[model samples]
Target: MTDAVQQKEANTRVAWIAGVGASAGLGAALARRFARGGLSVAVTGRSRERLDAIVAEIERAGGQALALPGDVTIESELAAIARQLVERGTLEVAIFNAAGATRAPTLDLSAGQFEAAWRVTTLGGFLFARAALPPLLATGRGSLLFTGATASLRGRPPFAAFAAAKAGLRSLAQSLAREFGPRNIHVAHVIVDGGIDGERLRTSAPQRVAERGPDGLLDPDDIADAYWYLHQQGRSAWSHEIDLRPFNESF
Candidate 1:
């Protein structure tokens, strides 16, 4: 049988998450949720150790997962991620969760730093969509979800690079949705407006956590649910974009 045929016959409950590490973060939470729901998740990121750790967690939960370490900004590596997923089974959901966050004032930002943000945030999304489209289109119905932040909608001072990159990603999602919605594919962008309640952030930005107050941070599991909801939305009345934030967050 052809590889494609074999893959089709293999477990087709495949979901691809890019740019998230395996532990105590959005990626880990998302991988677990999909795994529990019976989808084999393929997770990619820059850290092999973290990805492996995540895979172990899923395996322990009786959910199949694959850990592939890669840089989202690299085209060849990104393409490999898609190929690996296709080898496993049908690519039912492809999530562009990678982003670059080099916060700095415009006056102090170096050219290289600015470009790096775009490379991962904007160009990375483009390449991921490009790589995932064929497999997704083959299924005739799949979800392409991009995770966005408040920066996606506003260019705040001291976050020019990050904001610009996020804005570009949002724009790309809109364009793809318009062009491909009629083709039976769902493309949605989610705006995550507040700080995420994750171990990584708590350790790194304790002050921000303290400032946000009790229940002020966004939950990763909650965010993952939103993505799954987008994936399962009725194609007839699909949502192109949704903004999620803590109730206490300011607009």
Candidate 2:
């Protein structure tokens, strides 16, 4: 039988996550969670080394995963990755977990820096959706998930660029939901409203991590669980957006 035919017969489902960074980060966590759920996972990022590390860990844990390293901001690259995913199996979920930001005073923020943030966060999301949605529509079932932040809700000083980018991504998710939900495609925007207890923060700001204390930051695993839950939701009660934060979080 043809591979496509075999794929249909086997009903193999795949999940594709973009913007994977360190193994201890949310993108890697999401990959591991989905793979453990019996779905083959494809992870993409600019850092091939990091993506490979995440794939290795997932495979070590007896979960199927592969690395597809590329720039999320590049449409051609995303299209190629989408083709690769189609060859592997039926893509049931596509998550845009990529992020970019420039923390500076509004007056000091360069226009180029502002555009860069939008390119990575918002435009990257748009390109990924265009590439991923075709295959998803072919199956007539799938989920397109975007990762947002507290910045998605409001703009804070020194984070105006970040906030604008995230907010645009959130709106894109909403528009996608309205356009595709009726076609049985689930689109969700997850607003991560607080600090994440990930490698980046722990390494960059140890003092901040300590200040947060126990369970003060959002756990990547817990966030992954929520994404899994969203995918498993029945169409009767679809959720378009959800915010996540630690118990001690002010917002």
Candidate 3:
């Protein structure tokens, strides 16, 4: 390939991951994965400090990274994220990892809490996809991935709000995949079952570390591997949705 052509190829390799969450678990791992692959990465979240920290880690490892801290719940903020990427280059991969879960009995849950859950998971997923898709479609070929939870399929117990939100997101993914697949834009959703072994989950439920035992909790890095795999799938055999869990996690 000619030098100019090769340089253009490198410039077009960009990935955007949103909803870094408090500890930046899956989002940070994904940023590292793509950055290490030599792609220009832009990460977004409500926490500026956490985003910067992730950006620093990637940069320290000799990878390019940009931190654009913003809330996934806001439409304008998400639009700005998309605008920034379009101004700089193109969106090759857009991953929505922002999620929130609220545990409360239907009778005890406050209206605010229920609304907040839907805002972050369902509405937020819609806004992110709306902003990310145009740019992704501009690339002629790219991936739009959403991180889902087991709640996506089942609504049980104290997770009514979370389950409803996730189910909505899954539905959104399905609709988008069918609409954009023919245009070469691959949209997929991943249902992450079980507890993710990370700073947030480990610290929150220390006692469960032993309760579940070996291979009980899901690995963030391992889940990240699946995200990368989905992004790399060939157009001839694209996967619309995938479920991930630890080996010992029950169905």
Candidate 4:
């Protein structure tokens, strides 16, 4: 290859998306989408077994992937993942999707319950963003996307803990977007305002799941497409937030 071709290959961009939960159909779909785009991906989560499985699937589809097993709540683990990625090259995009939620009356909720939700929903995102910042800044142009829920923007009873944590994440996104935009880093928040079709829903309420229609429920691939769009946006036309829902789903 010519020197120019070699230089271009050496500067190839990679992306990392943290969080691959048990019911991570969305994450998996996003993996496939990125892989198809010819970008190497590092998928992070707490379970090595699950992460390995996802890597295998991505490789089988002719995509390059690395499985980095770690908990977002752990700082050391997050730092280690960042180091590994830096060794490979610059990270062009980082998506924070590691979060958990619980539904219950605020008056009846326990301290532990609230703490767990906050740790994953807000604290985890904070740590992940901090760990990924250096690499993004080094690249000079990158994208930081945060996956959020409708609760992040709206308050509802029986979802106080989840809502609070999500609200905090939204605020963080806004602050970071302003801080990072001048640095050539685009920070955006994605609000998923509807249910995602997954195996759990299939088994729990098959009829309702079917009623959501083929395209009536949000798909991880669709969300991944949105992420890609934001990543490719020019600095002059950057978007700070985007809301996605099923075509027929009521928001």
Best by lDDT: 2
**Candidate 3 residue-wise lDDT, 176-214, digit = tens:** 999999999989999999988777777777898778889
Clash total of candidate 2 = 0
Instruction: Decide which is better by lDDT, 1 or 4.
Output: 1
TM-scores for all predictions: 0.95, 0.96, 0.94, 0.91
Q: After superposition, how far is residue 23 of candidate 1 from its true place, in Å?
A: 1.5
Q: Which regions of candidate 4 fall more than 4 Å away from where they truly are?
A: 1-10, 22-24, 203-215
Q: Which residue pairs collide in model 3, if any?
A: none
User: If both were scored by lDDT, which would come out higher, candidate 1 or candidate 3?
Assistant: 1
List candidate 2 stretches off by more than 4 Å: 1-10
* Ranking according to lDDT, highest score first: 2, 1, 3, 4
Model 3 alpha-carbon drift over 4 Å, by segment: 1-10, 22-24
Model 4 residue 244 CA deviation (Å) reads 0.6
What overall lDDT, based on C-alpha atoms, would model 1 receive against the true structure? 0.89
Query: What TM value does model 1 have?
Result: 0.95
Q: What RMSD does model 4 have?
A: 2.9
